[model samples]
Target: MFCPHKNSYLQLVCAVNPRIINKAVDQAMQREHFDPHTELPPAQRLESMQPSLYAPHVDITRAQLGFGRIGLRLINRALHSHDNLVQLQALHSVLDQVQISENAMFLINLQLIYRIIDLMLDQDPIIKEKVCLILSRLATYYQGRRRIMSRPVIVENLMRLIMRDRKEIRYAASYTLKTLARDRCACKIIMQNEQVVEDLLKMVKSDHTGIVVLHLATLTNLAEWDLTRALKANAFQIMLTLFENKDPRIVSGAMNCMSQLCKHDVGKVLADDYDLTFVLRRFLKSSQIEVIISATGLMCYTTLTTRSKWRAKESCNELTKLLVNLCCTPNLPLLQIRCMQVLINLCDSPDIRHHMKVYWEKKVKTINVRTHEEWDGTSETSSYGLETAHNYRTMCIEKVETIKNDFGDNAQVVNVHSYLRRIREVKEHLLQAINWKSYKN
Candidate 1:
């Protein structure tokens, strides 16, 4: 029988009916009929009997009673309960079954959100961790995000959790913060907290790669909201140092953060730093595709500066080779595009342009000739080879065409073109002055 206090009734029944529980357990054991020679362990016997004893209370028809309503009731009771374990179980059950609509309703009921936020400060790490997870899930929806951001205390609590010594709590806090940071309102609130950036910087410096990556993601979103905070936190330097880490995830996280930071003035300064250039160059050779993509992207942004152009010219041979290899490969279209852009920037240096020209002439011509011959005449077995070669050549040509069009259409390339043109004009003016002096002498 269901009542307004159904959960409380169930709890009271379990507490007051020890004889009824024993009778149900005895019936379950008699039904199983265990052998007299074999004795079941007390723990196993209790576990086997638990379901039968609790079945009456646990079984509820969804048609007669809404599961969502029942789950909310349990959570509501658990919120005010003194037992931490019971509170955790109740919250976990509700979160596991609560739909988006139910979650929206929960947010509308401000007290529920307040209770969850209050639980975040609980002494038990498990309760705090679960609370963070619930908050993280709720933060995924816009309304839920707005609700969480509405309470400044929630953000303040999360910031403190991020700084805690416990790894699990830190991870949970970081994840929740990452989701929260995606919303502009929440991000603005987080950015206003001065300790947010400082705490993230500390996590980035941590030896644990997982913690560093989570914090990096949170910082990335925060940077999107306000880059000045990131710059003030020395995020550029932290990311540059993280670039050398052996973990691909750490490298990738650092590169992604650097990519976002590079859009700011401080990022431009960091990009032009000689040490940062050395790190980017080293990362270009990384075996991981993600590492290469992020590294090359950062390299492209760095080359936007005139000083970085000269610096890029010094690595012309290596970069040209890297570009050619990427361009020839069909799978990495985005990387190839970025590499081409970098090459276009390096073209301002005549020496680098000459090196690229020579390399392309030799390599492209040889590959084209071989592929053309293979396509023209092919045996049955050679047909497959011919097709492969044809596809390769086609991709290579398309890449070249794409690069050329990008050069024409790209605004960045237009800037590089103007810089080169200005240098040429200056050289011509000097040449004219020298010729005039010769005639006067």
Candidate 2:
């Protein structure tokens, strides 16, 4: 077996008393008749664990002990003690070990998962706050997430805690939920639980940016799966109202949620009614890159339809130029790509197409060397997909045309001339591949 005494992760736990640490672990190992990983059977199980109605497997073993199983076992026993100081020490020790996968499995084997969750109900707010933090840290791993999701009491407890007056604990509980909400299954659970949704929505007036961000982020995750509850909960207006908050974090979170909320027709209708395009347009100038990116995402929705495109234009005359500015920086690939997509959508409106061809290209075409978005017509199911399927013919035409236009052109040309040539080549191939002359003639 690996020596726990030498491993750095175990130093804090062993520091309490090296002898005690070894004794707990040695006693566990000496029980040769029992599997250290498995717990007592139904009738003989701890009353607390049996009530959970599920047999929790703790993966503690000699191999994983180096990850801090000894500390976890001691902490588990100490948490059940009536003494507050002992519980606090155990909780602090857990903070160090719970981050490890092996520690989480040991925690389950010790049947300590239920007790940690139960600790959330402790009358002392500090204990409850620490409990929420432990849960939060536990949730950052796959093993921890699996264990947490298995306990239904967690969601209810967190929801109730968010409603309480203790700000620190409320934020911690919401923080734990924010981590859980990132998982698809967790999103489903939150959406299905009407009380959870209601509780999150009621926290709309929270002054704490941390709690607000967590709640909004959690709701945003749920909205991505289904916009129904977001619609029913009035998420559109709630996000808009929260946008007025001075905190960029809060505004960005709301904008992200707004992006998902507007994916459905009903949500879009509400956005249009509220003149959201103007609001988004105003945020385009935000100093925070996060707010700008979120605004750009929401702006895409505004160009999804004929009416919305004009509305987007009305709110900001330099929509294409502003979008091009976002594309100027390749450092933010997502923002750059999203800005280009918004330009593509805006080009759906005939008048805006000229702005894209002239202003957009002049401003940022070099930033985007090649694109699949400028009408590839790759859809074969379009009823007439064969018109541009001849690749060899198009390539031959492209080379022939470039050679003809190259007339005195040399590799010595400046970067600008070369850049313009590339742009011209893209447009020429785009038209040639589609057999532009055949259709026009």
Candidate 3:
């Protein structure tokens, strides 16, 4: 007798016999049988069905009855299966269709996603690849991305794939990490994730550009989280070193991360201990606008934080010139803010102030270039006959400048500048945010 679990596992492989696979796929497509109001089936019975057969039915049951308790029970049972093939098949089936219900099966889906991930520790390379695919699928699902990293096993498995594998599984694992970081809890887990960091550093040193670049992107995304101190420091150092990679893509990814991290105190720490300036300067000359923009952003951060140290010792006029060039882009508001804020902080000196004044005038001119109709369009309309007070909410621009000065003589100027600039830029961007011009006319 053929095993249903084995057949389900085969469903994921194109190499499997088409007839047998199609037959199993057909069974999986059948209508589900379960009730939303009823409790799940006993564990043993649910475990008896193939994941391929049970996954669809569970999803269908949940959709029809607004519950998937039976499906969850079956998934839990499959999780306990001793056969690796059976477990892999179960993982494949569970991930095939999107889960739309918030019932108990949702819990089972989370549990099963972890269980498959647990298989990454298996000694078999094939099994490890299967686990990588499972995690990738989980991360790819819009719903699943939020919860995927909550289970430490998910990150653990992805790290394992990154560390021990050389195939596409490694890339998939990194992509999964990038996805998981979209969730705040997941980002914290990655920030404190020691083993993952060690594996990532090793991957960065590998000859494979794809693996290293994607991993760096994931790391940069992780920097968005409020990470613990020691882990944050370690990650900052590793990523700073990656800025030297010859591959422009790898350099860009590393620079993207540096641009963000350099906005934090830890960024100053890295520059003090590493050759952060040289790295940024070299990458700024990249042929790609994206690479140049990222490199310039990081330079803006470094210039803000390390300016005093550099100005006291060596001339930083070239850096300021490069920043001015970067600030000229009208479309790159974030970049312009970072570069402008850095320039403003550095402008306290008379010499730098003269240079910055020109850019400020440029910005002022751009700010006022609105069409009369566009300007009048947002003018508040008075509904009442009597004088109505229009509360025009205006930004306190001087208060921000004061705060920039308030950070004190030794304040992390780059971070301070970035903080103030980010707030204003966020508001500006939101105001200019797209309602899709097609609809907003």
Q: Name the top TM-score candidate.
A: 2
Q: What's the lDDT for residue 101 in model 3?
A: 40
Ranking by lDDT: 2, 1, 3
Off by more than 4 A, model 3: 1-90, 99-110, 123-127, 137-154, 190-194, 221-237, 260-266, 269-279, 306-321, 358-441
Q: Which candidate is the best by lDDT?
A: 2
lDDT of 2 by residue, 1-441 (tens): 223223333433333654445556768778546332223221233333322111122123111223345655766887888967667667767766777677766776676678899899888676787788888887776677777888877898888899974777888888999999888876766666667766787796665877898899888887888888778877788888988999887888898888888889987888778877676777888787778887888877866866677776663446666877777764444566567667667666656665555445545536644343333432112122344432221112234346657754443332323433444554344223222222354
Worst 10 residues of 3 by lDDT: 388-397
Tell me the lDDT of model 3 at 378.
27
**Candidate 3 backbone collisions, by pair:** none
TM of each candidate vs. truth: 0.65, 0.68, 0.56
Per-residue lDDT tens digits for candidate 3, residues 71-143, read 5556556756886556655555444433334432364355665566566677655456555655555564545
Q: RMSD per prediction, one decimal?
A: 13.9, 18.7, 16.3
lDDT of each: 0.63, 0.67, 0.55
TM-score of 1: 0.65
Question: Cα deviation in Å at residue 316, candidate 1?
Answer: 1.1
Candidate 1 lDDT, tens digit per residue, 196-280?
8877888688646677877887787788778887888888888877877888878887888888898887788877764455567
Give the Cα-based TM-score of candidate 2 against the true structure: 0.68
Candidate 1 ranges beyond 4 A from true positions: 1-66, 99-111, 361-441
